[model samples]
Target: MLLRDRVALITGGTSGIGLSTAELFLREGARVAIVGRSEDKGKRALERLEVLGEVTFHRGDVSKEEDSERIVKEVVSRYGRIDILVNAAGVFTGAPLIEMSVEDWDRTIAVNLRGTFLMTKFSLPHMGEAIVNVSSTAGVSPYPNGTAYCSAKAAVIAFSKALALELAGRGIRVNVVAPGLTDTPMLRGIAGSEERMREFASLVPLGRIATPEEVAEAILFLASPKARYVTGQVLVVDGGMTAGRVTTAGSRAAVR
Candidate 1:
């Protein structure tokens, strides 16, 4: 067990990559606190996870400072201290710059960037081991309609790197897991249908989208002692999507 008897707080833990990480941590012997904004989802997650190990759900919107502070206090009250903090809560928005509304932009930044900041700020005092932030391949690669999401995710990567340096002396490690095109409720919402999601998968060199469990494995590695020397880095789990464009043998580009 990589995290035997440790405590972990995972935001966005009710679903997708966050939920998967919670399960993995529990199996690794960590008492887990899963945070989210949806009460219904939280309840369901607790019901599903309670059998696995010691697990609790803290429902709060991480984008708000007060909520983030309260959630951290609640976790600390139950667990005494935090060994891992995973900021995985996020929202996605896409539009051309001129057509994008202020509300959409603000909401995207609030949940993705500001939420990470608030959670890390409050968790730091109680946290002793690691912080793994969930970013996206979109952080480095640009797309036509992802201005707000791309900007917020890029900021998360930069913030993690800077904080890693600041907290190195304190024995705290901060790192990032930037996943590409994972199959999750959030991505499903964006894709609108399974067929559409498959279409999106074709864009990746791997010919398939990642499972949430795969991304969670990356998070688990960063949070565990296995990565004790690893800090201030971005681990991209994109299945060669960002490596380079894939060209078929029949294509003119492949001829060169």
Candidate 2:
């Protein structure tokens, strides 16, 4: 019961890592609320979460200021306080910089960076609690044809660090979790083919892609008392993908 009696609100909680985190939070005795744009998905997540604890669904787009403000208000009105906030709503569109239109850049930035900021802005007063932002390794490394997605994620990392410093005196901890090649619906969409997925998996040192639950576990640790003294840090959950350098000899060179 690490989070007993806590109140948590998770954006993009209808699927993937957000959904997994909501389930984990509820299992640990936290009352949870999930925000999503799809009513069906939100309802399904609510149903699943209700089995563990008091759970609610707030349908809204994270990129909208009105939606973020209204959802926070609703959660506060129902739960009295928000002990945790997970900014996990994001979008990924891959295209080279020259081909990426202003709309593509704006849309990605709006949902990933701007949405995180708006959610934090509205949830902070109610958060005498913790904030866990979901960033990505793409923010730190250059990914092919990922200008928009990379830029937004990089901005998220910076935003969380700056906000963590500003909110330190308020007893609020802010941190970012940068997951690499997680097996989420979004990732599947990007993979587009089984061959691509396999190629991507082969790049990971672990020889596999991380499940959404694995990422959720890391996030829960940061939000729990275990990380009480930790703040303004980025936790990378990649399977050593970014830790190694390219070798000319490939796998055979390791035998030497």
Candidate 3:
């Protein structure tokens, strides 16, 4: 119950990691506001989340200033204030750099990087406790075909660091959670096949991909009171993937 009675605002909460985080926070006694772009999706997610506890949904695209401002205002209007903000809304693109269009590049940066920026900007004045920006291990470990995504995520980590420094004295802490491969719709869309998904999982030292709940746990930890003194830190929840592959007896571990 680290978030007991706190208010958390999570972008991209329609599904996957964002929705999972919202669920965890509510179970921990937080009044959660889930923000996303689609009204239909938001309502569906809200219906699912309501069965658990106090939750609300705000429909808006995170990458837009007006939407970000509107979403934050709506959340505040419902809960009176924001105690935690989780920037979990993001996009993934895997086209070869040579063929990647400028629009895709800009879109990637807009949703993953600019979205976090705008959401944080509007929520800061109301945020009294913490801000956890959801980065990716891709930010630190470059993957082929992930130019735009990697760049955006990397920038998010850097942004969180600078934000943490700026807000250090204000009692509002900021941190980043860089999750590795996880079982999510976005990943499913990218991998496309079970074999491809398993291939990705095999690269991890832990021999498996993370579950959305697992990454969400790491995010909640950073946002909770236990991390009061922890800020400007990038917590990599990759199940040791970023730590490198493990080998035994001079043999490579079997890929899942």
Better of 2 and 3 by TM-score: 2
Report lDDT per candidate: 0.94, 0.92, 0.92
**lDDT of candidate 2?**
0.92
Candidate 2, run of 10 with poorest lDDT: 246-255
- Candidate 1, residues 1-256: lDDT per residue as tens digits? 9999999999999999999999999999999999998899999999889999999999899999999999999999999999899999999999999999999999999999999999999999998999999999989887888999999999999999999999999999999999999999989999998799989998887779999999999999999999999999999999889987676763466557
Instruction: In model 3, state the lDDT of residue 212.
Output: 97
List TM-scores for all candidates, in order: 0.96, 0.97, 0.95
- Mind giving the per-residue lDDT tens digits that candidate 3 earns over 172-228? 999999998999999999889999999988877777999999999999899999998
TM-score attained by model 3 = 0.95
Deviation from truth (RMSD, Å), model 1? 1.7
Q: List the candidate numbers ranked by lDDT, top first.
A: 1, 3, 2
Over the stretch 56-162, how does candidate 2's per-residue lDDT look in tens digits? 99999889999999999999999999998999999999988899899988999999999999999999888867899999999978689998899899999999999
Worst 10 residues of 3 by lDDT: 247-256
Q: lDDT at 247 for candidate 2?
A: 64
Question: Model 1 segments beyond 4 Å from truth?
Answer: 249-256
